[model samples]
Target chain A: MAKNLLDVRNLSIHYKIQGGWVYAVDDVSFTLEKGETMGLVGESGCGKTTTGYGITQLLASNAYLKEGSKVIFDGKDFVQMSTVPSKEYKGYRKIVEYHPEMREYRWKRISMIFQGAMNAFNPVFKVGDQIIEAIKAHEDVTDEEARKRVEELYKLVGIPVDRIDNYPHEYSGGMKQRAMIAMALALNPDLIIADEPTTALDVVTQDRILGEMAKLQKREKVAMILITHDVSVVAEMAHKIAVMYAGHLVETGTTRQVFKETAHPYMEALLAAFPNIKKEKKERLKAIPGSPPDLANPPKGCRFAPRCPYAKDICLEEEPPVVEVAPGHYSKCHFAEELYGELGGGESNE
Target chain B: MSEENNDVVIRVRNLKKYFELHAGMFKFWGEPIYVKAVDGIDFDIHKGEILGLVGESGCGKTTTGRLLTRLEDPTEGNILFEGEDIAKLKGKELKSYRRNVQMIFQDPYESLNPRFTVQKTVMEPLIIHGIGESYDERVEMVIKALEDAELRPAEEYLDRFPHELSGGQRQRVAIARALVLRPKFIVADEPVSMLDVSIRAGVMNLMLDLRDKYNIPFLFITHDIAVSRYMSDKMAVMYLGKIVEMADSDEIVFNPMHPYTKALISAVPVPDPDHKHGRVQIKGEIPSPINLPPGCRFWPRCPYAKKGICDVKEPPLVEVEPGHYVACHFAEQLAAGELETGEEAKEVIEESEKIES
Candidate 1:
């Protein structure tokens, strides 16, 4: 309804391999509102991480963007700058620096809390000094001012200020994660991309971290793109949910819509695959047959057709268009209505 | 199974493992600091039942698994396998015991050898145990193992290396290797934690199927309470280096009496958004195992701890409820709702303030 803070349209990212390009992320698009949380969830090699990395321009050397892709952030066409050439010198070949302005957006406007970020810190430096350096790198602040800000950020993330002086090894896994979250918030960024933020921690520590992040998100009003393979985590944290399989976004909707009125068969299978801790024991868990398709040489049509239980001949020959089952809910499936009808109703779900 | 007279497959009595640390330079200046990793633990695995050992990192769950498989010799106590003590087993007896008990590690990538093919990896266990008569017989055994692990069309995967397979495929190979010998008991330490959620259910179902088919008991160790609840029949909650509570899985999940168990259960994020978990936050960091706290090991961070009594003496594992064991001095009071939540620790603060005032 309101103007979206970040709009990614027709985004495709590929890696140049020996024979052909590895289509890591293909035709994936989603919008994130200001102060909203969107969860991008899938299994391994589902292009969930690549979508985040491509938006952040953190791809490796062998990777390159496909033609006709757009990433609009804060009313700016950031993806088009990749082809912008420098001024020609004496009618000769011109050098292209390739989106040097995008570097300025990093950490100041958009930042990331990486997976296994606790081990990413330098062991030699004190945690506070590292954060101080990060703060100084983005803004023209004095050493005294940066130090005070570092202390404040540490306290904001629920870490005791005194422990900020300790080295990374001195802190526990949970403390280091909290420290990473503090580092991501050092520059007051508008958006934070967290990839499996609490995967490595225990349940108790993960509970504390998720609770803290939720509190901080509400207080600071910073939009977040939480990427994880755990559906339960997304159910608790995000306002919207996007389900990806292979390199395709099979479904997208609000959290309630996706969880309650799921249309895509892949989404249904993925949901049933996870064992619910709160529910009673069933006779047997319904695990989806077969593995994810190979991204390097994925099949034509729908990527999930081979594993879809309700897939038909049309599903194998042509890819399904994005069909809006509800007002704001979309599923990339041909038989979405029939599937929903079979489930009885699209409005209520237990 | 009856409570008193059930046939136990593995009986662990007062198990202890203390790793002595050398602190000073040249190893001459300081007293040895013992990292009490698994200190005085006791439990029994019933025949054909899964005993889930749930704990956080550094809580000695993995160490307990390693000790059970004879990978690490216990410093004290007896590990009776089928009513026979295995601490003093040697040579042929130890080899035979190892054949009956196998271990499946967490990381599938690191567990299997890179150079070994799927066939070689599964066959190596059989070759070592001298199970089959000839090489031809071993090949048949390998194919059967792969099929039994649910890697159908086994011929297609025989030549593939670990790198060529997916995370779930590699884990199945690891399971195939573990099950090639048809072990009676297994110590699976977070087998599915390293896998993707979609494929995780398949592996869990395979494990349950194998357990039922082979009638094998498992010491399932994991930090995830949800996965443990799905897999294990009996659950044991561990903290620091001791079992804080042990009971039936459903009872432990529904009506947890121990404060630590309550905190752990409340910490687990349920998938449904409407499921509201009680907020029983256990504050502070777990104490370092190198120097454990006196009295109760959990006293430093326990919310329901009393001042004089809980800090003065450690409580033994008492059977407060039938078939439900708890190791806390105030287990009865806490279960009975007699003790306050200690939001401000009003009594403790008042008592300490009285001394100061």
Candidate 2:
């Protein structure tokens, strides 16, 4: 098997509130190979964004990782480096004691495309100068070389090079998003974490942007962790899929395997929630009933049991184990095996 | 157009709303530029029917809804509500007209007053319109409206503030407020876009139930085509302040005639991974509304736009098929697959196809 680019095991992060800790990301684990894309999809406050921030070690000041959490990147445990500084970690510890080697690793090996591009850019500075600053901050390049790279990035993201001198306010919504992507790819990082990149864009603009991002990811061999609530976008962009609900990974599998033979009830409900334009019959969407549980004091057993349609007494009484339904597919549910068996047997019914 | 039938609740004819843009230091003397927000759009909402106005952000769907609710005065046109022109109503007459037409704003958090309780929020509309005879009567009406909006045991939420409720619950309160007046027509602007996916269907179902129960016509404005298709009986595709296509929701989504509508429908990402969308990627961004193209507003970005006709003469919105309106010079040719995709659009698709492999 090809060496994994990133391997996260039992990663748990919690926010320190007034009374208790908010279990934002609880014991979530996943692996990503180089040039592969994994989509982290869930509704609001389901810890999808927190998971992305945990991987990058850019969590907020109030948030902290739990014990035994491991984020092994390129054969090195990044979580361990932060807690126990060694001789090789002295350079990182001197610069930032909290996040070891993050200054060197961030934007050099992994970059983030934020949710709101308008707020991400500096309104006072020109778009080109901001991207050039990003390039110059990481690499020891002169202003001329950074400017040339910015021009090339503009072309790559389908933005006009002449508009690089304009401020962020001057560009349209689509143009600003392209500039955000350009800045994320400024250093040619190995991985990109894009959180709702196309959520604010129009449908046509979003389609074009997703297409461009997919092409660039393939050409540059960059792994991505696309965090979104839209399942269709993940279906189109991601090779592997991870579904989250109430700070737990409900399901994780290949995109085709997960979507085709859905094991977890949350994943099934989520897929049914979206209105498909291609569906032959116009049927009412089966909306998942009730709201997500509070993370500060979540449910005892399955977090999704309160809203799940197939919840039984056992689901509420005991935590479900992660069962491997297929060779590489894992589902965190009590009836994952039974659901997978039924779905596999009746594949043609759908 | 038949007055005897009396089915059409709101008939908007040649509606135009142009916002003037002033530039430069001596802009008072200079020719003032206008952003043609709702430039001569015409549609009718029949009784109990939901006409969905779908488009991008600046495509004037919201402006049309605002005009229908009499929030914004149109520059020129006739707003015939039940065959009476309401374009210039004022004072008591405008207030009476507004009592029959209500608007549900997009953001429930911003629309509701922060200090007001749910009871006061929903009751203010009734008090303004003099809907009930007494305080007790108005409270009863508020409870009924809240119940109609799917907020079970409405009394439980009477004293709750906006912040106390969740996003979906806030939207439900907004819907109940709109319903308290029992208006003949309602304009819902992106009602469920801010809501979570899990509870969005419940809200949509509530609206559908309300429409059926009251037989009230609706003007549903949204950017998502799939949601519009599910909610609307008739759908209109707007681009650059004009209705590019108007047809039955299923017909328009399945067999779109206008190039812009085709591109819009095709652009919607379906949930199925195996289904391959017939990509009709339009080039470039929507042109600035202030300086719109001379002829067809979508010609600059349309994949099947012709040079001479689409650039020189604006095509009138004509019925190419039964009950289907299309505003394109080559609508028939494009529908027949006689016209080829533009060169630039083809190149863009080819360059962006590396991911499919």
- Name the top DockQ candidate: 2
TM-score of chain B of each: 0.94, 0.96
Kindly report the docking quality category of candidate 2. Answer: medium
Q: After superposition, how far is residue B176 of candidate 2 from its true place, in Å?
A: 0.7
How much does candidate 2 score in TM-score? 0.96
User: Which run of 10 residues does model 1 chain A get worst, by summed lDDT?
Assistant: A86-95
- The positional error of residue B113 in candidate 2, measured at the CA in angstroms, is 1.0
lDDT of 2: 0.87
Look at candidate 2 and give me any clashing residue pairs: none
Model 1 error, position B247 (Å):
0.8
Write candidate 2's Cα lDDT for B29-99 as tens digits.
86778999999988888999999999999999999999998899999999999989999998999999998
DockQ of each: 0.48, 0.58
Poorest 10 consecutive residues of model 1 chain B by lDDT? B348-357
Q: Report the error of model 2 at residue A224, Å.
A: 0.4
Model 1 TM-score on a 0 to 1 scale: 0.94
